[model samples]
Target: MSWREEHRSNLELKMGKVVRLLGECEQQLIDETDPPTKSRLKSQISELKGQMRDCQGDLDSFGQEQVTQRNLALTMASVTYEDINFVITALLNQRMISIDGQDNFQPTNPEEKMYKNDLTHNIKFFLDMGLAKAGEVRHFVENNAKINFPDVPERLKASLNTEYIKLIRSGMRGDELFMHLYKFSSHNNPDPLRQAAGLAVLCYFFETCDVFEP
Candidate 1:
């Protein structure tokens, strides 16, 4: 959707029109000598105000839907460990940040917080390796998988390569990066291949698939 064509604009237009209509109706009511004429104008003004409220509700719902769509789209992307690490570091390095909303980056203690901070610095090293390079993310993701789960299936590795390629192009934020990580960590069945995709990410991040924190 074009930015100008969004629901907010429609609401503003509706509000402005309603305000003008209400002002005219109120003025007419004040001028009318007949009680019945005044009652009709008062009813017209109330109807216009009700329509404005409905328009405002629609705008609020549309804004919420946009946020939901963006979240779901990013989740479906299911970023690799490399992408997650890259984004977290970007925030620590004072690059990208949340222009709105809260970032829950608290660590349990000073040491854990320091460790999280260090992870952010390490990401800068990865960033210096040319984050925009086509094969860079793929190489880092595949290498992470190889180091953590040497027995990862070939088909899963290939799918990861494709997803990393897409992730590099989209430019997700730090929190968004981790949110997708959670989405990527879900497995559907006993098929080791499908399960391995999720396991590789958990193992890479938390040192083991079973020990990983949500």
Candidate 2:
């Protein structure tokens, strides 16, 4: 399940517990004779109610945030090689990729290293040139951009097309393409979030193609 789903489920479970506790507190208040004991039970019931309200509020807020993100994701254009390359360039410019002596792209940090390893494994196993390369490119982008890697690829693909998949299969790869796209896209666009969202959309596309195993 996605993190959002898990979070909502947890909130629901907590709310259920709070309700049960509140019921017990009310029952205790009815059975108690001592003034102090009755006061304590009332306080406990009040606290449980407050906790329930807080949990409900958090659940509602999370739902609203999900809707907003979905709308933002939908506003993006279909993913293209240009978009993928743009994200890759942004990562490279940020110094997230390390150039090995053999000219291979390696990770420059612990987080990047993890993503790199994951991509390398997927490429080795999946053996789909378009998907593998695209996945690797997205791994770099998502790691550097600091966005939570999307759980549903289809959600990400809401704004992507399949044109870039064929291009990657036909031997389009590496930092050169990334740099070219970056220069073109960043020429007039100053917003980094826009670039980040593009990368995320590309990630969704690759994932839908079964390239991004993670």
Candidate 3:
């Protein structure tokens, strides 16, 4: 009838066609019979939902700040292969270092033994990575400032450095080379102080352990 009314009717017809097209698409997807394809589609839908939830959480926390977004990206980049390798070396092989006073530092119980072993493995990993050396271990025992551990915190570094000096001065000799590992392995020692002492010793061992043989 009227020009405006005709235009509105034409728009409604276009909207109806679009709705029909969407419904047809839904029906076609529903008719798919491949089990693997269906499983994949379901997995994709689940992932999208999880991602939507994460996006919603992020928006609530920081709300569209481009700088925050960039900071997160940078932080992710910082936690790469080298960082992971170093941390794993620290945690699993405590022998990568050498703490001082190994003679006075015996763990009195079985739990201490376990802790010592784990720390020893961590030390081995560090040595394998070339983060430490045997001569450095001996030097640290005589005077800690000689040995360098980049990832160790400053507060802990002083204590660890002291341990290295103590281990060598106390008598880490010959077959007793494994004394550091035995003292620090997670399975051997449970006392936090003892375990930590063991870790320092292991770092020295890793630094100095005979890499050529093993």
**What TM-score, computed on C-alpha atoms, does each candidate reach?**
0.27, 0.30, 0.21
lDDT per residue, candidate 2, 53-145, as tens digits? 576567667777534332322223123345555644443343122212222222243224325324443221111212223433455445545
The local distance difference test score of each candidate is 0.39, 0.42, 0.36
Best by TM-score: 2
- Give the per-residue lDDT of model 3 (tens digit) for 1-214: 8975454334333332332233233333466698887776556545544543443354344344423332322232122223323333454443335543333232233224324433343233222212212222233344433455543433233343444445556866332444443343323544433333333344433433211111
Best by lDDT: 2
Error of 1 at 85 (Å): 60
How much does candidate 3 score in TM-score?
0.21
Q: Stretches of candidate 2 above 4 Å error?
A: 62-214
Q: Provide the global lDDT of candidate 2 against the true structure.
A: 0.42
After superposition, the stretches of candidate 3 with alpha carbons farther than 4 Å from their true spots are 1-152, 174-178, 185-214
134-164 per-residue lDDT for model 1 (tens digits): 1223444566567864533233333333333
Q: Sort all candidates by TM-score, best to worst.
A: 2, 1, 3
Ten contiguous residues with the weakest lDDT in model 1:
125-134
Model 2 RMSD to the real structure? 20.0
TM-score of 2: 0.30
Query: Comparing candidate 1 with candidate 3, which one achieves the higher lDDT?
Result: 1
What does each candidate score in C-alpha RMSD? 22.2, 20.0, 24.6
Candidate 1 colliding pairs: none
